[model samples]
Target: MRRAIDWAFRDRRTGAITVAQWPNLPLWLFAGTSLADWILNPPGTVAWALRLIAGASLAWWAIDELLRGVNPWRRFLGAAALAGQALVLATAGP
Candidate 1:
């Protein structure tokens, strides 16, 4: 778990621990926070924003995956995740 967090939160471009170089940190952080919010809190603005950002980012990633994905399953999963996120974003929160 520690290794996973370090790998995910690390600065990919610089191979260092810095705020400026984390490309996917926001996405990961939003996902984590969203999950926690789902468990502990009611839907609200934070949930909306988190889903909106995560959905939009994943949608864009799906587009890229469709174009140049490494494998068939990954592309399929990306598209599916984007769809699921979009659905949740649209229907969730107030």
Candidate 2:
């Protein structure tokens, strides 16, 4: 189980990028949780915090993609989603 969890967080791929690869599972889980929170709850402190965390996480994913040169599509999508989330969250009523 520990090995599996460790595997979840480590990426050892080195070569041309392939579509077969998935994004980091643990990060995706965290991203999904934040996205679900936004989908399920009213905009407030908790929601804002979740969005902030989500945006940051997505941004990290994007940067990691850039560094690894693995998935350009994921990087752009993550960056765009992060920007939109940050914009809406920042503009939202308190």
Candidate 3:
């Protein structure tokens, strides 16, 4: 159990536990569009566009994390985030 835990969290090179890092490009895009969507409160079309962009960027980020994360915790976080987004979209009414 201890060995498994260490394997999941340890960085191969640095021997540090790495769960997350600074935001990457897709994350940045998601954040920017989310902020714009909240602050600007644009008209219907613009609002939809912002939401679409935000969702797409977030999805891209999630996929990248799932595929390339440095640690198991990071990969789990990505999976959870992706699932959460899917839930939101599923329940969001037209």
Candidate 4:
């Protein structure tokens, strides 16, 4: 049974399947909780934190795409927007 479970999870293409997909439940829970809190209180600190995180993630993804040599202009615009959002979050006071 254990071997079967492991085989099922093992990535056939790269042979490097991650168990993090299941173990990051707590992270997803925290994200959901923060989203709910932001929905209930729009201009709260938690909302700003979430915004900052999202902006950073966006910028990171944009940079990654650009590094792959895909759509320079699109990535630049996306990174710029994300940086602006991060700046807004930074300037927002608690």
The candidate that wins on TM-score is: 3
lDDT of 2 by residue, 9-79 (tens): 43345534344456585369566867688579856777767766676676676556555533555444556
Sorting all predicted structures by TM-score, with the top scorer first, yields: 3, 2, 1, 4
| Candidate 3 stretches greater than 4 Å from native | 1-5
Question: By descending lDDT, how would the candidates be arranged?
Answer: 3, 2, 1, 4
Clash count for candidate 2 is 0
**Alpha carbon lDDT of residue 7, candidate 1?**
58
Query: Which of 1 and 2 is the better model by TM-score?
Result: 2
- Model 4 poorest ten-residue lDDT run: 18-27
TM-score of each: 0.44, 0.51, 0.86, 0.35
Where does candidate 1 have its weakest 10-residue lDDT segment? 17-26
lDDT of 4 by residue, 11-86 (tens): 4445664332342333354466557656777666776677556555555554553353223343445466557756
Which portions of model 4 miss their true places by more than 4 Å?
A: 1-41, 70-94
Give the whole-model CA lDDT for all candidates, comma-separated: 0.58, 0.61, 0.88, 0.53
User: Whose lDDT is higher: candidate 3's or candidate 4's?
Assistant: 3
| Model 3 Cα shift for residue 14 (angstroms) | 3.9
In model 1, how many backbone clashes occur? 0
